[model samples]
Target: MDDYQRLVVAQFFESLPNLSPELCHQFVLRHIVPALLPKTTSKVDVQPSAFQGSMSYTAILHIHSTHGGHRIVVQFRTEKQDLSGVTEASCIHGSIVPLVTYQGMYEELFVYTSPFAEGTPYISVLTSSDDFELPLWKKMAIVMDLADLVTRGARANNVPPDTAIVELTTTLDKTQHAVNDYAFQNISVRTSISACVSYVLSQLHNIVTLPLTLTHQDLSPFNYLIDLSTGNVKAVLDWDGALYLPVGSNFHFLDSLFGFMTLKGWQDADDRHELEAAFYDRALDSLAAQGYKGITKEKLELQKAIGMLLYGVERLLKSKDEHSEHYLDGYLRGLSFMKEPISSSY
Candidate 1:
């Protein structure tokens, strides 16, 4: 890259002074080019990346070497880096997770790179009808692939088993405590949402211990890059914050299979009952491998209902508004289907 181009990239981070000129220079030499990242780099170009991460400043590093040109996404973190999270996810779900090519601290900044994925983001398809044709079956296939990965990711870890004897009401009480902690104090809408919570709790009166596992909390459409031609996911991005949680918590992500949220409320897609049922069935089969005592499909669904209730209340806690409240009510009222009402990611 030319000096002027370097200056351009450097100047772009003026509002973020941590990207000092020296740090930018070494980033270009070490990460953008050199080593296995690409051999003997020659000409190059750098531009800001479109991947809008909440915790970092990101850019695209395009390099032309002896063999050919290559592209990598570089991120400078504003928070403590959990670089292993991306590597761990890649170890299991490499097909959908870009492997971290390199990671190091230039000065105090934590920077990492992964091969740039080539495809349309699932979010793009959701926004415009003409981005590409994504049929119902193809979307179903994507959901299955995601479900398989989550189950495998959980089992991949040697998590300590939940040795507590299976007492059903204990789990329900934990839900009640979470509600009292995270969902309480929002007096305006609590009453409106109370019936929904009570009904879910009642359904989950008898249950088994659900083993904890790592969950990709940000399973938004934008994080998934789709192969538009086949309607499959090519890469799952942004794993810096991935951590372990209850296995049933993943049910909240099922909303992405339907549609995304908008200001008018949720703009849902055509009903995919076939896909939805298949996903639940797949979950029951896969999670059963963990062999928690006294587990049953009914108990699993009960846990899902608990997950559904928590999903609503926790979200309500984060955003107390007429719009959020309106959708929270609709979703819990229909917890059997575990439908998502509001768009968490636009």
Candidate 2:
């Protein structure tokens, strides 16, 4: 481990004061090895990684023996990390989610493991796949899985709707402040960005009042997997910051399937095919088929708009530097509808 790696590990074990590397080693030998490999003794290789996600300290375990080899991923939650309603998520999401074969706590750290799922992250697929051949069905498959996540994971183990709305409202308000700050610093985009945000905020109630579901907080390419051949979903990874919010909160990511984001905004794949209407039709139909009725086309349009607006602003605020700012500027510029007002019935 380098200096930064040492620092990362040191920071992680701060909360687990009683959990040293030695303890983790022994625990793996006594508990994990037996549980995973059974009575036969195996050469256990515990590799502590610098690969920590937004919520946990992660490590890799390689167990080799006469039978075979097993590679497992281990994660220890930080003190502030809250995976409050995620225990049932795997079962809810089925094989499309990483399977957690083991989980337990030690020295106040929430630790768990999943047998490594074999597939490339969706980001990699998009980045390397040939000739921009990302088909529409792959995008639809992801949306279908999302519909399943929404209907099956409905309200179960979710935060109270009112409370969830309050939290979401706080986030929107914070973004409003951030936008104001950004506009104050960069006067060039001030008026246009401000007006767009104002339009979104003015129509925000339409977004908050829709059906509530577990919103995957981070819906980036890095968090999901796609098959290279059929382009279907392989697995959805890292449910750490999952929260309860109105449907379509995660819809912003659905665009990446049919389009690619450049420094200049969302450019449609294969040049001119924007599939938003197709997605909404499939999603609404899926919801109705699953007995989650009452979703009108009007509501879904508003959901997509509000979700995209909220997410775009979030990326703008979370942008680390001017390179990111340029990319965001292009993305926001393409959202011409945000500048147009919506008739709110909420």
Q: lDDT scores for all predictions?
A: 0.61, 0.62
Summarize candidate 2's per-residue lDDT along 1-346 as a digit string, tens digits: 5565567677767766778766775676667767766866667788775344444666778878787887787766654344554555676777777755436776576777786766666766665566445666766666565545544555422455466557756766776677777743345454555555555555554555566677777777777776766656677777766777667667656555556666554465652234556556767776676666777655555555556657666666676456545544444454536435534443
Best by TM-score: 1
Top-lDDT structure, candidate number: 2
lDDT of 1 at 199: 49
Q: What would the TM-scores of all predictions be? A: 0.71, 0.70
Stretches of model 2 off by over 4 angstroms after superposition = 1-38, 42-70, 76-80, 99-111, 131-140, 147-152, 155-174, 183-193, 202-208, 263-266, 271-274, 304-315, 318-320, 330-336, 339-346
What's the count of clashing pairs in each model shown? 2, 0
- Among residues 3 or more apart in sequence or in different chains, the pairs in candidate 1 whose N, CA or C atoms overlap within 3 Å are 96-236, 261-343
For residues 98-167, could you state the per-residue lDDT of candidate 1 as single tens digits?
A: 8765476665667777788887667666666653336777787788766666666554324333433223
Return the lDDT, model 2, position 184.
Answer: 36
- Give candidate 1 regions above 4 Å deviation: 1-39, 101-109, 130-133, 153-193, 199-207, 285-298, 308-312, 337-346
TM-score of 2: 0.70
Model 2, residue 269: C-alpha shift (Å): 2.6
Deviation of model 2 at 79, angstroms? 6.7
